[model samples]
Every structure is written in C-alpha cells, then in structure tokens.
Target: MSSAEKDKSPTKEVDTDELYQKTKDEIRPKLEYLRSVDDYCTSEAYEAISLIRETCKSLGRSKEKISKRVVDFMLEKGLAKLIVKILRSLVKRNDKSAYESRAKTHSVAKILQSNVKSREKKKVRIELVKCGIAYPLLQDLGACDPNTEDPRQRIRIITDLFSLRLLTEYDNPSVIPIYRSAKAVDILMKFAQVEYAIIQVRSLMLLATIVNEEESSRIVASGECILTFVEMLQKAIDSKDHHYLFDIKIDEENEKEFFMTGNRLTEGLNNLASNDANKSAIIQYGGVATLTSILRSQTSKGEKQEAIEALWKLSFVESNVEVILAHLNFDTAALEELKKMKSSDDSKLRDASTGLLHQLEMINIHDEPPEEKGSSDDQCHDPPPSYEETMSGMNVMISYNWDHQERAIQIRDKLKQKGFNVWMDVDKMRGNILKAMADGVEKADAILMCFSRKYKGSACCQAEANYAFKLRKPIIPVKVEQDYDADGWVGIVTGMDMYISAYSDAVMEKNWSQLFGELESIEKKD
Candidate 1:
C-alpha cells in the first residue's frame, strides 16, 4: 500500500469469462426467449444480442473480442437470421471476390477470415446450420446473381455455412430443404465446379445429401444437375482417381484429395440415378461406362455398392443390356472384384454380386472356358457360295433376338454351306423392323424360329414369328432353352408340332440334323 507500490500498481485483467457468466444470468431472465438462432430475428433476441454487443464494447474488448462475444450470443440463441443480417451488413457494396482489397472488407469477412483457423468458429458454424441457417444461406448461394452487391461476401458466408455443416451437421434433416429450394441445385452445381477442391467437394456433398432420399431425387435430377453430376463422375473416372475401400494402400497422404472428389461425386450420381427417369439420361450420356469405372476404381465399399446399384437400374433397359454386360467382361478388373464379392462375408456384397452375376447371365453373358479349338481338317471351314445362290428362290428366315445372333449366324452359315439359302437378319435391321420382317417372311419358304427366353421377350422377334405364321410360311420351332415355355406365339404358330430341343451338345446336333431333314422334306414338298 506504499506510494512507491501504488505507483507500480499492476493492471488487473478484466475476466471476460466472469463478465460472460454474470451477463448470462442477468440476460437470460431479462430476455423472454433465449433459444435458437431464429430468436435473433425475433423480438426477443434483439435486446439480448444488442446488450451483449454493447457490454463487450464497453469492456474495452478488441474488435475481434467484440465480434466473438456477439457471435457467442448469436450462437447461444441459435445464430439464426440475426447472424445472416449482421453478416449481410458487413459485406461491402457490390464486392464479391475472395481476393478483394482489405480496405473494402466487412467486419463479418474479418471475423470469418480470422476464424478460418479457429476451432470455436468451426463449432459455431455447425451450430448455425443446426439452427436452420442452411436454408437462407443456400438461398443466397442460389439466388444471388453477378449483379448482386457484396456477392463475394455473400458467397463466402454461404460456403462457410456449408463447410461447417459438412464438418459437423452431416446427418441433419435441415439439409434436404436447402436443395429443394428454388435455384438451389443451380447454385450448388456452379459451386461444384469451383477451382478450389474444398468448395467443389462441399457443394457435391450437399447435393448428395439432398438426393439421398427417394422423393428428393427428382429435384436433384432436374435440368443439368443430373448431367453435371454425371460429368463430374466422368472427369473423376477419366482421371482414374478413386481409392478402393478395402485395399491395402488407403492412406491419407497419397490419395486423399482425389478420392474425396471421386467418392462424393459418385455418391451424388448414384442417388440421382436411383430415380428410373435419370437412368435413361445417364445411359444416354454414357454415364453407365463412367459408373462402371467407379466400380473399377474399387473405391469404398459403400461407393462401389452405389455404382452397382446404379448399374443394376441401367441394366433393366434392354437397350442398355449390352452396355452393362460389356462392363462385366473377363478382361475388366471389375468382374473379378464382383466375382470375389460372391463369396464375401458381407451379406450386402454377396447379394449384390449374386444379383449382378445373374443379371449378366440373363443378358447373355456367361462364365465359360475359351471356345473349344475346332479340328484342323474340318470341312465346315469352307466358305459360302455366290450371292446368286442366296437370291435363288427359297430361304430359311430365322427369327431371334440379337442376344442369340451368334448362334443364329452359325446356323445360317451351316445352311449356306449345305446349299440352302438362309435369309437371317443377324446384326443389321434396316428401315422399319415390322416392314422388314414382313418382306423377309414373304420371301422365305419357312421360318426357323430360334426359340428361347430372349426370343420370347423380344417384340420384334415375336413380330417376325407372328408375320411368318400369317403369311402361311411353314414355322419350324427350334427350342434353344430346355423347358422354355414355348406356350406363347410358338405354341400358337406350330400348334403342338414336334420341335428340335437343343439344350446341350447331343441335343443340339440332333436338333441340327432334324432341322436339315425337315428342310429337305420341305424342299421335296416345294
């Protein structure tokens, strides 16, 4: 207490914590409601936030401290409209660039820039999203145009909110409404193309979440969102940037960035393609191949599952059957991965594997050894005769699906070698299919029906059979699949006629010989 000691008095630090604690007690009672961020926009949050802002200023706190306290109050009340309002106020008029000069910088920008490395800021961002800030933030992201004043600051605020949500509020339901909002998809899509990896991936992440639900899948599929999603996947796949989920090399250092973009983009594509409407567009855009590449990436198990599922949906289209089956070829690494999955301990993997295998087989892809080497001396190697022979009078019109065209072609070559003209449209179908079928049947002596499940399933093939029958052309039913219910058009045309069944080699040869004899009998009848 001496004059010398007093002269050397130490300045005491004002306890912001005690100040905050006491303020909380006093403020809580005086304030009517101290709940969500929305309270800031409400009549109740106004006085409390202003009080905290003033007290922090009066406490001789730094600008950063005042901002922190204001944020704390906003965060405590759920950081709702009041934060966005304050943030909007901080944005400089007509400035929208991240690299904008500091002279024009807004206080909100300063706070966000300061907190860019702040953990508390991170948590507050998430809390803000939980308080339903994502909706308005997303609206700004989508709604703002190049002409909007403070566009850059607005974008930063919107993106910052998303960055925080991605870090913390990943599973929140509030995200669904964000994309469902007007122009939200466009805004997200634009951001998704940003040069920055963080911005692009975070935008894609939000998109994936929005499309995760079946009902919202349509909204995500609207306009170029589907195409953009697919293009993102195509770029990732083209770059070969996915990390296999169960692989040994999944370390953070090597593939973290690429895998992040690839995984999120793939997830979004899968979710959007879950809607059947999107599948046709996807297949049209060659997205099936891109998706196959995703599976080939051997990315995460979840990502691969999503690709498999999207492919499964694409496979349902008969026109897409070839594309899907092509991806399962033996040379492609994806097939082996799928085959390995068939015996996996994971039930989902095993089931998806089994289903895909069955689907491929149904699409005419089968597991088999290399085709047996033909004998060196076989005279069947002899070529067919001149075109005059084919144009000569009677021919055998074989009705079949393109799936079994190889077999149909083999039989045509055999008939041609045997001096019988065989008119079979294997790969080419010119002009109107029905008209072509009618003309082909009209010029034929008899129609050799390559009857099977696929033949039954094809409308065009059935059309030929029906037309040939109506033309009074002798219908010869060749059963390719044993016990195949030939009970439809085949039964109607042949009328319980004895047919050649070729389910195996012995049966196939026997049927082939019988078919030739039947042709000879028909030749005699002619």
Candidate 2:
C-alpha cells in the first residue's frame, strides 16, 4: 500500500485477549470491595455484583472465572463499602448502559430465580423486563434451575419483582407472553404490594391492551389488582406529584390507545356498576374521585381530555352519573374548577363542557312527567301553523365564508323574501361577531352552515359548529364548492344532511328559493 492508502487504513486492531485482561485488572478490586458487605446478596448489592460480572462478560471473559475473582475481591476490599460506592456511582451516572449492565448481572438473576419455581418463571421474566432490565438476561434467568419446588413461589417472585420497580416499560410486547400465562395471571391478580406508582399505572394500561376481551375482563375483575391500581392513581393525583404520573408526555401521544383499553375495562366495570354494592365499592376505592381530581388538576391537556371521555363512558351506567353529579355538587373546588374551564379559550374545553351540559339536560328531561295522553283538542290547538307559516316565523342562523359575502347577502335576501327571519353577519350587529352568532344560534330554529374546504380550517366556524351540535339543533349543510365534503362533520349530527347549491349569482338565487322550500318541508314534518 502507498503512503496515502496506509494513512487511510485502520490502525492495528486491539487484541481482544489483551482487552479482556485489561478490563479484569480494572474491575477486580471493585468486585472485591463490593463482596465484603454484610447484605452483599441484597438486591442493590447483587445489582453491583451483576454489573461487574456483565462488564467481564462483555470483555469475553467467563462469568465463572469472574465470579471467583469477585469472591476474592470481596474477601480483600470489605464488600459493603465497595458495593455501596458502586451503586451510588451508577445511580449518579444515570446512564442507560449502567442500567443495562446492572440488569444483566448473574447475581441479580440468581436472586430473582431463587424466589420462583420453573413452571412460573415467566412472571419473573416479565417483571425484570418491565424494570428496564435486559430481556435476554430475564430469559437466561428463566432457564436457570429454580430453588423452590412449590409453584406458588414463582408468583411470589413475580410480586417481588413488581415491588422492586423491575417491570416499568410500557411499550414492550415481550410482556404479552407473560400476561398470556395462567400462572403469571394468577400471580398478578394476587400480588398485594406494588413497588412503584409507575408499575401500577403501566399495568393498568397494559391490562387494557390485552387483545382477548375475556382475559382482559378477568384481569380487571380480579378485584385486588384493580382496586390497588385505582388507589395508586388516587394517591398520585392527590399528591400532585409529576414523577409518580410517569411518562405523562408519552401517555398523551398514545391516549387513544389507552382509551381503547380503558373503554374495555370500563365495559367490564360497568356490569359491576349496575350493582349498588359494586358501585359503592368502586366509589370507595376512589375511582370516581380520582377521575374528577385528574380533570381538575394541572395535567396535560390530553389527560384532561381523556379523563372527560372516560367519565362520559362511565356515565353510561345510570348509577355512575349519579355518583359523578354528586361529586360535581358537593366538591365545591371541583365544581369551581370545571366552571372555570367553561371560559377557557380551548375549543375542546368548551366542547366538553357543552357535552356535559347537554347530558345534564338529558338527565333532567328523563325525570320530567310524561305529557297527557288525551290530545285531540291540543292537536287542534288553533290548527298547527302550515309549513310556510312556521318558516315565516322561524329564525335561521347562517355561517358563511367572508370571501363569499355577496352570495351570503343574496341568500339572506331570498330567505327574507320568504318572510323568514334570517340572522347573517351582514344583517346582524357588527361588534362581538362570535357572541352575536352564538346568540343567534341559541334562538334560531335551525342553522345553515355553508360548507367548503375553507370552512374546516376556520376556528370560529368550528366553534360555532360545535356549539350548534351541542344545542341539538338541525344543521343544514349547504355545499357551495365542489371541494367541500360532509364526511368530516357527520359525527356532529345524524339528522343533518348535505345540500349542493350553485355559486353563480343567478344559480344561487334560484337555489336559495329551493333551499327555503326544503326548510318548509322539514318544518312541516317537525
């Protein structure tokens, strides 16, 4: 090779053999120092031992040989101080590699393995993986000869792992394998202590993700775990500790996924909610209180939104709403908090409050006395007005694009010609346009939303549409542009239908007349 080629070539490869020797030289004293401690086999102490063992393994040294060195080192260095120093250092670094190395230690796996049996090892494996431990090490731990003959010992190991904050990862699919095992399920159901708030919350979220609804239902119905999880969330919400909230940012992004799981859990719980005993149990366990607290807290906007949606789902059970309404009434702080939300600039907050108000209205309406059955004279009450008469008296609110003002004016003229009261911005008070539109919407018999591609992008229009939908008024969607599509707004109204009207002055003039005729037809039907 020429001089340039030589310069470009890599330097002599470091001998793997020499590197292994060098690593052992550096770690030997540290290992010796760690083993001298009295609680040397304790979880944290074992974690330090595991780290040294893993470092040796990474350097291609045999664990058996390193284990001998560690024993020798512990004999010489006073194990307790060495282990404490190592753990403290690793904790300070807060490095991912250190965590990984700590996870892979044979000592750690041995400690985990000794607590469980062969048949029930999967739970230990899951618990380890959740705790940010390496899955391969967990697998190796599972393959190890377990100390106990009793199968329940395995469940105890799993519970211990959970209590140790070992299973914390929410995105890992490896957990599914453990959840699928009956032994693992039993252990999860019976495990009395949860190590960390994150673990409990993640487990609840994970239970929501199980594809099998029956299995999911069983897990949620376990009583012990569900109640425990609810209590955990309640404590976190009440304490207002963000650390305990765990992955709040990520949860916000995957909220819909959580909701899908939560909805299933809710369905299972709703059956329980039907029973007065179960309902009280749920309330006493802090489910309703926790949910309300979350709504009132300084949580992520997404969490607040999800909590509202969850409350709505829970409200389907008749008893659930009564509980929520009671909370809303007596919890002055919570009531004030929600009332403050109504004035928020966020459209979502406004929409949620509107939905809640509508629900309250529905509940009240259901409690009202039924109308008298005899109505022959009531039916003939001055002979109900004809469709044209109704149209003439009814007010129609129009939401149209500013760029299409002339068309809106023309349409307003046509409606007025039919003797109908029309409230378009052109004819209404100029200041506080939104307030004026809201007032018109409240009083109008119907709202005519002029739909176009531009309409969807308008915040004002969306707010108005949301308000109209909340009011349960008939919204007649008139499509003026070919680009306009009604599919997006379909969820807002089932009675609302799309109508196409021409944009040209002459054609629009003709369509406006037809539009009134259609309105007259609807009025007659009503």
Candidate 3:
C-alpha cells in the first residue's frame, strides 16, 4: 500500500483497544490516589472510576477515553454534593433582611428615581401604593417632587422607607404605617417562610387574627399564601413533633375564626372522612399520605391524643370515614395504639376516647331517632338490671319514689344482710346524681322498681326506670301500696309478677324475709 493510501485509511483507526488501555493507565492511578483522600471518598465515584479502569484494561483500550468518562462521573457527583450543601446552609440561615436590603439599595431606588424625575417634569404627584404600605404614607410618597436629578436615589430612599415600615410591622404592631396596603402582609408572610415550621404555624395563626377581614380574604385567595401555610403544617406533622400539635391553643376569641379558616386548608383531610371535594384536595396535596405517616409515628401520649382528635374530626365528614376505618382496620399497629389510648390515665384522653367511641357506636348502629324507636319517656321509665347476686356479693339498685324513702331503706338494709350490694337512691345519690344513677343501673343484674303512686310523680324514679329499659335489663316491679296500679305505669314490666306488701308495722317487720324470697326467685330465673 502507498503512503497516501495508508493515510486515507484513517491511520488504521488507532486501535480502540490500545487507546482505551493507554487512557486507563493514566487515569487509574489518579483515581486511586483521590479515593485514598477521606474528604473525596465516595462509593459511587470510586465504583465509577474502578469500572471504567477495569473495562479499559480488559478491552486494551485507550486511557484517554476511560479518563474522560471517569472525570465526568466524578464532576457530576461532586457538583451534586456541593449544591446540596449550599442549599442546606442557605435554608438554615434564612436571612430575609439581607436580601431585602440589597434589593432596596440597588433595584428599587433606581426605579423610584426615574418615577420621581418623570413626576417632576410633568408636575404630577407620583404615588407608590403597595399592599404593605399605609394609605397616609402612600399619599406622602406620591406627593414627593420628581424634579430632582437623582430621582433614582429618591426611589431608593422610598424603598428603604417601605422596608423599614415592614420591619416595624414585624417588630411592633404600633409602628405599622398608615398605609393599609397588602405589601406589609405580603412581606411578613414571605419572611415567615424562612422561620421554622413551629414559628410559621404561630405566625400564620397570628396573621389570621390580626389581618383585617378584607386583607385576610385577599391573602387566602392567593393560592401561594395558603399553600405555604399548609406546607408548614405538613412539615411539622411530618417531623412527628408532638409538642407542636398540642401547642395549638384555641382561645375563645379566635377559636371560631381559626377553625373556619383552617377548615378550608384541611378540607382534603376532611374529605378523607367524607370522600368529598376535600378528598381530591387531600390526595392532590399529598395530605392523606402525610396523615397516615403521622398516625404511624410512635408519638408521645399528648401527640397521640391530638392525632386522634384530629383524626376524629377528619372522620366526622362522612366521606372520610371509610378512609379512617380502612386505616384502623389495615394498620393493626395503629389500631393497637388507639386501643391502648382508650385506657389512658389522662381524664381528657379518656373523655375524648369515650366521646369518639360513643360517636362510632352511634354511627355503626345507625342511631334511630327517639320517636322512631320509642319516646324518651319510655326510656325514662325502664329500670336497668343489677349485677348477679353471688355468694361473694350481689348488687341491687332500688328505684323507688323518694316519698317511699322509708320503705326503700328498709329493703336496702335487709338486702345488705344477705351479702348483696344494695344501692338505694338515698345512699347512692351523692356526687353527680345522674352519673350515680347510671353507674348503679349499669352495674346491677336485677333492678327492683318499687311501684307506687308517688313513684310516677318522681322524675328521678322515672329516669331510673328509663335507663333500665334502655339497658334491656330484668326489672321486677314490686307494688308497695294497694292503691298503686302497676298496669298504669309507662314501663309496667310484665312476665315478672309484682309482690305487694301492706304498709303496716307487722309487714314492715317481715320485710326482710319477703325481700329475700323475691331476690331468690330473681336469682333462680337467671
């Protein structure tokens, strides 16, 4: 082959195998040296270099190709780490003043200067109206002379003044300039974005309080503003910060306002309960996933309590009930946690759980209207059964007319001798009259209704009867007087016959034996 022919053959294509080999020989040592440096050590960088080097050596390729690839890989990884560190530091500092000062001194002043010069030439008043400025200050700034040669400098001064006004609003409410401009609110909200989630929550709450109705409407209307507020709440929840959850204080004056405004943001959460519009919002905003995460956290007692309360509210919306129930059913861990919470020692926790349980029960059972099932009056008259009488002890709740307090006591004393826990209104009616009655009725196995004319006249006697009937307990109506007709009573319990005793000294003396016989019969039936 001639020299010209050989040259036209692309110099024999500089054998790729030899080229890769050459490239790897030069870069491999450099990579190893760098990897030995602790500061530059990274598994990914090392792996990339090592793989390139091995491929080149195996293929007998040029070192230049391998070196170039390794360099690119290292640069990409290094740049990413550098960018992340920069962002982290910037986020940590969050210095709004620095940025604001720079903008005012440089950009804003130049624009203001030009506006002032134009105003002076036309002898026109130049007003700067920003949402953050007060009306009075805005009017003053507008009236400034624009004829000055350094109009840009004047503009800078105006921006500084505005910035100062904003800073004042942040520090002291009294220093807020006369301008009721939205500029101040905008600046404050932006500043709050730099603060921690806890601070952001508090600031948003305060802003919701102090901002005028019109201003609040405008701010909320701004999707960005509302989104920022939600983001703060989400971050706090994600952090598993129990302290933040309970730190929310709903004072009397602002409680309604907070809830009303918060409802808008929490609609998505509520939708989880009702599967309504809020559900879409929740899924869109990733709220459901966040809430599930919060529920999964091994939070403090207080946090758990707050979480449950929040969940309950979310579940209140019909659409979200299925979501909540699904979580409860599928998340066995969460369900176990909630079950433990039911037995919490904190009265508030217990009360909250009790209320939730009651709501759940009512919902599950499809609570029927009182009139549909039976009148409240019917419930008022049916007494509850007492605990079963045991050799250890038995409890009997005597529902009788206070007018028959004497007979009720006599019966109670006789039952006490038979090792029965007898709860008569006279002795048991102390703290929380209604609660005491409920306890007695709930704990009793058989309820003894001392039916008499006076029993119908007493509201308390009627209440006891109602509770017993609602409980579907065994009730024995003992007619204590001849004139009292059991058939006329509202809850005239049948199947169990009534025992009548004369109001005489002779019968009163034998009341113990008579009561014992009735008690035995009730036990035998059980």
| Residue 164 of model 1, lDDT score | 33
Better of 2 and 3 by lDDT: 2
Best by TM-score: 1
How close to the true structure is residue 445 of candidate 1, measured as C-alpha lDDT?
A: 84
TM-score of each predicted structure versus truth = 0.40, 0.34, 0.27
Candidates in order have lDDT scores of 0.53, 0.48, 0.44
**What local lDDT does model 2 show for residue 250?**
21
Global CA lDDT computed for model 2:
0.48
Query: What lDDT tens digits, residue by residue, belong to model 1 across residues 51-110?
Result: 544443343333445446645664565334344554443233333222231112222322
What lDDT tens digits, residue by residue, belong to model 3 across residues 447-500? 888876445433345546766887987776666655434432333453335564
Give the lowest summed-lDDT range of ten residues in model 1.
376-385
State, as a TM-score between 0 and 1, how close model 2 is to the true structure.
Answer: 0.34
Task: Give the C-alpha miss distance for residue 242 in model 1, angstroms.
Answer: 4.2
Cα RMSD for predicted model 1: 23.1
Q: Which residue runs does candidate 2 get wrong by more than 4 Å?
A: 1-187, 190-202, 211-213, 216-224, 240-281, 339-357, 360-526
Ranking, TM-score, top scorer first: 1, 2, 3
Superposition-based RMSD of candidate 3 using all C-alpha atoms, in angstroms: 28.8
